[model samples]
Target: MFRNRQEAGRRLAAALASFRKERPVILALPRGGVPVASEVADSLGAPLDLVLVRKIGVPGQPEFAMGAVAEGAPLVTLRNEPVVHALGIADSDFEAVRDRELIEIERRRRAYLGDRPRVDVAGRVAILVDDGIATGMTMRAAGRATALQRPSRVVVAAPVASSEIAADLRREFDKVVCLEECDDLFAIGVHYADFSQVGDEDVRRILSHHATVAG
Candidate 1:
């Protein structure tokens, strides 16, 4: 596991050095991905921006992702059929929570981005970074959504991932670069030593610094 996100990002940047000349745009999922993406952007001399996706959590157990909301030009929602079937979650129930989370996502986007233009990925490489991958639902949704924006390719980068999900992810993205995959994995937080909750303020600071650096 990484000592922290910085070390993880540095290592990831090394692996992605070949893309430096491509001027690939680094789009990180907010909160957790910010630190890692900053390091990659710094190394690649590319711009960093947030891909604000909200996981529609199951009721009572908010940790279980029922689906995800992909924040995009038209926006997109992908549902987890198995989770819905197993939980017997009705359309009304799912819609209720999805709408609530979207509100929070919008608030965060406004806070971190304001009127700042987002990174243009059309015909350019789009790399999606996250602290780690668990269910891969959000990352999967994010990758597919990014592809629709006409990015030439989509790459999912993470410090670690569960082996089972890693295989499935390979089928979805053009490329997957996970540092390691553990078979006995339980959760993403367990892999990190400094697994602190990255707050909205942290995201805002990262975005501000990224803008200055890119300029």
Candidate 2:
């Protein structure tokens, strides 16, 4: 298990050493991904930015992600078809959750990033980093959003992910770089010793720090 998110990011950065030559732009899925992506951006001397994806969870069961919505030029969304069908979630209900998440995505974008310009990924590799992958919904949405910007290649990096999810992500991203593979990732927190909630302040702090370092 990772001692903490920072340690996990350091390990993940080491694994991603080869990407340094490509001059990748790191996009993190905040607020949990900020710390992890910071190490990578620092290691590779790359520009860091946020993807701003919010999970659309099931009604009443908020921990269970039904899908995710990501902020983009025209916005991007992904739904868990099996979960929606199995749970018999109606279109109206799904729309309600999606709309609510879109608002939060905007709020986070304003809060953490403010008027800062987005890093251009058009001709460079874009590395999307998250603390870990559980349902893969958020990461997929983030990938889709990144794709819209016409990156030369899209890469997803995480500290740990289920073996099945890692393999499945290959179809969505050009490269998948996960430090640890597990047969069953019961929860992303299970792999971290200090998996505390990442607060808004933490997100803002990391972004500010990265901007200073980049400048």
Candidate 3:
């Protein structure tokens, strides 16, 4: 078990030291991953950026992700065709959910990053960090979005993840760096002693700190 995201991030960063030579960029899945990624960025002295991908949840079941939207000049979206077909989800319904998520993504981008341009991952190693992986849907979507940017290598880094999902991530990503693997990851907070809620203000502050440090 980890004491908190900070400690987890530091340990994860140590494991990722080999990638420092690659001059990698740290990409965080915001709201929860910001703090963790911030530590990694500090350790590597790399540019910190947000992935800005929101899950397109199923209608009336907001927790169930049918797809996800990632912000970019041209937005990157990936849908689970099997899930949509199995659930008989209408295209209109899916689009509506995606649009709503896009709005949220824009809000977060403004709130946390402001006018700072997104770090280009093209031909660079891109490491995607999150607090932990539960269902792996969001992270998988994030990987797909990062792939569209043509990164030389795409790596998913986290403190803990389900053993099964960790294996799946290995196949999808160029590399997967997780500190701990558990059979049951229903609640990631269980692995941390202090997994407090990471508010919008916290994200804003972390991003600002990284920007200042970078400058």
TM-scores of the candidates in the order shown:
0.96, 0.97, 0.92
Q: Residues 35-105, candidate 3, lDDT per residue (tens digit)?
A: 99999999998989889989889999988879888876577788878889999999999999999999998
Task: Give the least accurate 10-residue stretch of model 2, judged by summed lDDT.
Answer: 206-215
lDDT of 2: 0.90
- Candidates 2 and 3, the one with greater lDDT: 2
Better of 1 and 2 by lDDT: 2
After TM-score superposition, the amount by which residue 5's alpha carbon in candidate 3 deviates from its true location, in angstroms, is 1.0
Candidate number of the best lDDT = 2
The predicted structure with the larger TM-score, 1 or 3, is: 1
- Go through the candidates in order and give the C-alpha RMSD of each one to the true structure: 1.3, 1.1, 1.7
Quote model 1's TM-score.
0.96
lDDT of each: 0.87, 0.90, 0.90
Q: Which candidate is the best by TM-score?
A: 2
Residue 63 displacement in candidate 1 (angstroms): 0.5
Poorly placed runs, candidate 1 (over 4 Å)? 213-215
Displacement of the residue 60 alpha carbon in candidate 2, Å? 0.5
Model 1 agreement with the true structure over 9-99: per-residue lDDT tens digits: 8988888888899889999998898999989999999899878898999998888999998887678888999999999999999999999
